[model samples]
Target: MPLLFLNEKSWGTACDPARAERAMADFVDAVRAAAAADGPGTALVSEVDVKALEIAEGYPVNKWIGVSPRHRVLWQRLRGLQGRSPVRSVFPTENAADHLEYRHDGEVVLGLGAAHFMDGIAVSLPVARQWQADSVALERGELVEDDDGTLDMRHDTVVVRHLSAEPHLDGHLEWIRKTRSEGVTTGPRIWDSRADLYPHLTFLPRVEGQLGSLNPHWVLSVRRALERLEEAVAAWDPATMAEPEWRTKVSPEGETRKRVCRFTDLDGETRTFDLHARFTPGAGRIHFRLVPEEHTIRLAHIGGKIRPDL
Candidate 1:
């Protein structure tokens, strides 16, 4: 299931206490409705965010919750979630390093940071510009304005904004509904079909072309392998990533290891892409290169497995 983190930065004072309470009620309702349509997902929260929820706009939000018996019960359930933790508790262990460092303003943004680290969605109120935008940008470890007055990142973290607005709520529901129907659409980015695979996979341009011509029969197998690879890449340290044996035959090229295992990248530099996985016996193969220092995978080829004897 998807993991949604509460955007702590979205909490702030408002001029109209009633309006603020209404907005909070709407946001909570939207979350519950989405969960009902899809299966319930883990909602990550921090002590800071929960306390902020208790008091915002010069009024206690819990009082608003008490006004509605339904809301009071729903709020209690959300408060009992196991994801509630102290600030910065979401950080991974010291050994498993990654390139995507979480950053915000000078102050800590615990929820967004945790969402990014965990490859989950950051659920925010329509308050700050960073949370308001469909996408957000970061520069030199800080959230910065974008060229088009928006925010973005390639292979970016997903941020669902403005739960109270119908348009934005519709967008969030689209994701949830799709996730329920199609399994891969759960994370920050939606991978509803083969067309939606590129952004999440991040394959090299030439390798992408190879995917187009692949046999139709092996397509599902390939998708499964890539999905597993995506999960592994997110969870494991790159240096030791190959330790696990994958069901889809993730391993180095065997007989042709010396010959076709090396390929030139877009930069015209010869690089070894020995890591490979088979779609099936003698059917199709996916060979890729891993950049450990950057924690990235550059898919070099996706075609028939090379065989020296053949």
Candidate 2:
């Protein structure tokens, strides 16, 4: 699950108490929904103690939760193991990453539990620019991307304003899927690799035969390249969507590109699997044909570099 950090900086002072209470209510509801969607205790509040914070001009967030009738019930379910626990303070035990900040395009964003956005956590927008809290004002419906390119330029980070949004959920699920793909080396025999590991892939029989002949050292690379294809196909319809060059690239063009890129499909007809991902520049490759009609990628070859001059 993607980490949802408590945007403590979001709790600005000097606002109307009633409106702040309502906004905090909404934030609580959003957190509840996020926790419900991702699992219990998925939302983190703050390490500095929420008691000192106010949602509105007069109402402290902790006080509001205790006094508000609706929040009283919901907080009970999400508090976890203890009545004193208002919000999760520590990162989940399942998360192994040792870091909390990630740097992108020179601007540093805090509270990302891991290195990459795909596997790390999300911090609310307007996050302390340059480590100075209160530097950026938190506003509802504000696109931090416009301010710092946090959402627009990066794949990670979610805003508390809209916890149920598609992009946030998709990113979290993508992390889970990626984690599930991590242990490719311990998978079944080469013959079963296709069915066991590459469920999203439609392997040509010849490609399966080639799998057995591939260097064991190179198998991990093949798994990674194919995983990229699987992620692309699962995320969008290739027929209507543009190719994700970031994940898989057009097989390089050269004289050997024509002969090496063509392969026999399961139908016994020769077809071009022009889209390819390289595991190694000149040593390993995954040649694949995208079947837009079926919305899947068929692996034509899974070993050795195929180039223009070959």
Candidate 3:
């Protein structure tokens, strides 16, 4: 027998578990109306109340419903439903937050927390049939962008030659690897100068004075030097540090030459690092150091000449 449901407007037939589903559906509709009205004093759905109802109804929470993160209640509910689902690929958001967009094939199955669900309402069905359609298109080799705006194509698989035990450290390294692979010449520079003092060790200038005065070839040199530094760090081994062959040290010895830097690691331990130089024709030189304990490399400085003070 179909269950009868009574709301403020009308009565309707809600069969068995569909009663809960229908109630949720109505809640979504109310949220949508409130958002669209854009009027003062509009009441939005309470996440706590929605969660309680979902728990009471025993509904699957993490289903991939084509909604954006702006629909907080609906988005979180879908996340809960699809939390355990297998994902084929993961993509980072533009803001570089820890939360990532998880995709199955070319369709987004999860990670919509950074998206705008209400924006897709005009084209998307109330129940997320559009996402199913996208999945089919993906299977057909069609390209699409996921809800969080990440390209849905299968990225070239990167087999990490060296893996870090620390998840956060590994994530930071992966970000650098991906940035290098994509040939991203401009973006936020890693500010670890306080960790070690080689001077301002960055490829791109963060200040107004650095905008145009930088030499083009020098920029390329710094970039390539950084890439090589990343590769070397990826393959570094602490156990073999005693071997001279394993340690590739460059020249220019004196008070003006390379120096050791000491900094505290994420674990709150002080570690010492030795600087090495990589020269680029017409672009001067770049100084960097490998910290084996942290499983990462740090760019120390870039300059026309080595400063004795440093």
Candidate 4:
């Protein structure tokens, strides 16, 4: 039998007590209905321990039991567990193999443990694993990225970008969805590669504007690029700073333009770091002082779809 309830630690809007009590009332109604149909035959009714709550989150189920009409009336009149006072009690432990449906932000995200959801945002996951996995930890300033693309650096010191707002790193999917068919890659070109790339994070061009998320890996990669870029910019000489050609004359009509690299560092400092000098045609090579950390730092070269300076 399935149980309809909230996690012990799950709270919303700073866990308003009055609001939580009302929600618990509805939850009890839902629970009793589910329990009536699943009674005795199913173990799900007793599987959840609402008392196992974190005190810090404000909504302690043990204390809030009297708020729910169903639990309140039952406890007031002495129900099954009413005689049993609030104390450490033993309950049958669930099998490790038992599958549980855990959801957050209203969407059924795969994984284990209880979590909090609100305002279309999933906040925390209260997971206590028996087995340990390899872990790594370091200071916030210790982490760095290579240079290649634009990025938004938040307060996520040791961030798991893949598990968070991923689309922020994968560029604006909305823009792509709205303008999905604009073939900027190829039709007639004198270049050997395409400009339309997959490795991009879509951000509003303005300082204070709307934003979205993307594939997490894409964001991590962009952060790596930023690391290299920071190094590249630091190593730049003042004399060679103005040499980067932001424009190139391809023809009398069609000129080859370049992209500007932008970034917001962890300190909330925003900077436009120049990468490379010139894509001077017939210089025998695409010789620019661009961030030479690695090609993996590129947004235009995503999915191997775009190649530059051929």
**Considering every candidate listed, which one attains the maximal lDDT?**
1
What is the per-residue lDDT of model 4 for residues 1-310, given as tens digits with 9 covering 90 to 100? Answer: 2222233333323545665555444434433433343333212211244355432256566776655666567433323322111111211222211222333334443211211000011112112221011111111211121123322222211311111112221332333233234322221210111223322122212311110232222222223333333344444454546322222211110123233333453336554322222110111111122333322212122111112432
Residues forming the 10-long window of minimal summed lDDT in candidate 4: 114-123
Candidate whose TM-score is highest: 1
lDDT of 1 at 56: 57
Q: In candidate 2, which residue ranges exceed 4 Å CA deviation?
A: 1-3, 37-78, 81-108, 111-228, 231-310
Q: Estimate, for each residue in 174-218, the C-alpha lDDT of model 1 and write its tens digit.
A: 656654565542222222354455432456566655655665434
Better of 1 and 4 by lDDT: 1
- Per-model TM-score on C-alpha atoms: 0.47, 0.40, 0.28, 0.24
Q: After best superposition, candidate 3 residue 256: deviation in angstroms?
A: 5.8
The digit string of per-residue lDDT tens for model 2 on 158-242 reads 3222232234444455444544454344223545755655566798877656776776545544665676777777776665686
Candidate 1, residue 212: the lDDT equals 57
Candidate 4 accuracy as lDDT: 0.27
Off by over 4 Å in 3: 1-183, 186-214, 242-252, 255-274
**Candidate numbers, best lDDT first, in rank order:** 1, 2, 3, 4
Candidate 3 vs. truth: CA RMSD? 17.8
> Which of the two candidates, 1 or 2, achieves a greater TM-score against the reference?
1
Q: State each candidate's clash count.
A: 0, 5, 7, 21
Give model 1's clash tally.
0
* lDDT for position 110 in model 2: 35
